[model samples]
Target: MNETVLYEKAGAVARVTMNRPRVHNAQSRVLLEGLDEAFAEAMADHDVRAVVLFGAGPHWSSGHDIGTPEELADRDARPYRPGADGHHQRSWDWNVENTMRWRDLPKPTLAAVHGMCIYGGWMIASAMDLIVAADNAQFLPFLFQYQSTPWDIGARRAKDIMWEQGLLTAEDAHRLGFVSQVCTPADLDEVAMAKAHRIAALNPLLAQMIKRQVNDAQDAMGFRTAIAAGHSAYMIANLGHAFFDAENPFGSRKKMPGIDEARERAERTK
Candidate 1:
């Protein structure tokens, strides 16, 4: 497993922490692989009845470390020898795979979110069965315009967070249905641990059966299709020279198109 993910189990509860404070816990290829391995271990562990997913340091995660569109363009402009493996494709593939594995885990899982839960971080929480958010935590889904894809699971969840109603406050999320519960930063750990313990006390056989029933129902109804539609509809970022560069063309604090605008343009183009 990659060093970016830390896995430990206590009795029937498993804890998975994203351990990259340097990048604000950004989701890199290494972290993605580690998460995959950890999730697999959790699935195979019969003794574990629940999982607690959280991040180390102050924040949860930012998102992919793509630097900026300018960086992509710079790389595209230069003549470079192709690697044996398709790194770009693998990045996307690994993210989707590991994220889905967590989402589809048979046992219950909770995301203990604090600090800056933005972009990919938001998606990770949305994928879990339950979310326990701290009052100081801010969930931001500001990546709808940077890629051209549709109907992805992450995109669907992002839409609800960014639009549907609006960016959710901890209270709003509880009211709007994304958040399972909200607590203060000081009490977040206690609340999350208590919830996981409650879940762990449930009959593991019945809990897993119920979990699978819910996921299987979604799959039967073509959940991935809807996700793809959402992704395609909202992610209208074209792979152009502006977006492909070697360095971040847009500086750190730059603002690009938001979800509504990107969705509109994508729909119009279609």
Candidate 2:
């Protein structure tokens, strides 16, 4: 099978690139597993102090590959069968548990994003320690349909994004504190790698402690609890979509106008 993720070491920094460029690095079962393995590998490597996650394509990610039935079947056969505990539990596992694992990693992680970062893409980026976006990047929080919004970009902004089907420019994301920095498209890699190297140069133990302290502070404020609450609501929303709004099942069906269409419609109304 073709590799869905590529891993490389540069000095103390480990780079993990989502490799399915043809599909804009959409997360299929293999791709998700590949990411898990890549993260694990980076964590295990003593030489690695920081990790950079990005996509090897024009776009960062198109989000989850819901249309790939073969990949879905292959994923179900894997040990982490997300659906093993039923659909709701499965959502928690895939969307919450797995992402949290990466979020709580001991070392710092940076996401270098450009082009389209949608739905699941936003989920992964939000879990990272920092996000560096290319000037041309646009973020779509389409997971609003799944009821996961407020925590990533704050409450009032989330409402606007979801209600209007808005696309956030890199500048807007930076102002909202979702993106740490924004660089020109041509300089994205250089800027992100420089930040990674700077972090890698720090004492790994101290770096980890710093990360833990910040995460702990957030957790103390019920960040995790809020996410869990969102997941519960997400489960209900998903069931409604699956049964009643078949045309827009998880925002993946072609029968639906999709985010691009929704964005246009929202624009016209304005």
Candidate 3:
């Protein structure tokens, strides 16, 4: 934890906080690398029986850092996976592979969600073992990498919240089994720590067995496959931006409303 992430330890619970409050904790490469190191630290510590993820801002996150000046610089300098294609390779590493790795982490992990949890926020929170959300929190998704919404909240509920750029309140998410508990904003931290304390009290091996037992069942039901396929579908859409006919091959949503004509057409769709 450096400038972007804050790592704190209390007894057996490790709190990993996203610290980019100015931009609603937008995930820049600096933040992601710091977050990875924090998680790794928690994973290696024998005394840390439970981990909690928090955001330090008005919202948990506004989603991926969509081309901020600092983020663009970091993206250019970040190394790509050696054998893998470099196009968005870093994105795949942090949001997909790392997310899944956190999902399978041996110890109990919890997300204390408050404010707006957008697309990229979902990538982090949904990877946790449990979630404690503030009543006012918003759960929004626009199909970012490693989309596990369908697995987290059943196929039907996933479609309801995601089919049309929709969102769910924390209460609705709790009802749908996505959030473990919903608390007042003032009590969110205390509630999350209380649960983490309970988890830490349990025998570590017992805790891990329970985690793996449930995840193995989920995996058996094709959770991993569905997640990979969801990202594949997302990329297809990301680069599938076009005007009328299929013209632009490498165009992305970043280039959407590309030309004057395309901007006019986009307005019409609105």
Best candidate per lDDT, number? 3
lDDT of 1 by residue, 20-136 (tens): 887778776567778878878988998888999989988777665554443356446742345413333343365554666677888899999887666667667777888899987
Residue 237 Cα positional deviation in candidate 1, in Å, after optimal superposition: 1.7
TM-score winner, 1 or 3:
3
TM-score of 1: 0.74
Over 4 Å off, model 3 = 79-84, 242-270
Q: Residue-wise lDDT of candidate 2 within 78-161, one digit each (tens)?
A: 545233246566566666887888889999999999988877888888888999999989887754223335766789999788
Candidate 2 lands at a TM-score of 0.88
Across residues 1-270, which tens digit of lDDT does each residue of candidate 3 receive?
578999999999999999999888888878888888899999999999999999998888767786667887875686564422554566577788888998999999999999888778888899999999999897766567888887778877777656555567799789889899999999999999999999999999999999999999999989899888886776666555521124533322242211233224434544
Sort by lDDT, top down from the best: 3, 2, 1
lDDT of each: 0.67, 0.80, 0.81
C-alpha lDDT of candidate 1 relative to the true structure: 0.67
Supply every candidate's count of residue pairs whose N, Cα or C atoms clash at under 3 angstroms: 25, 0, 0
Candidate 3 accuracy as lDDT: 0.81
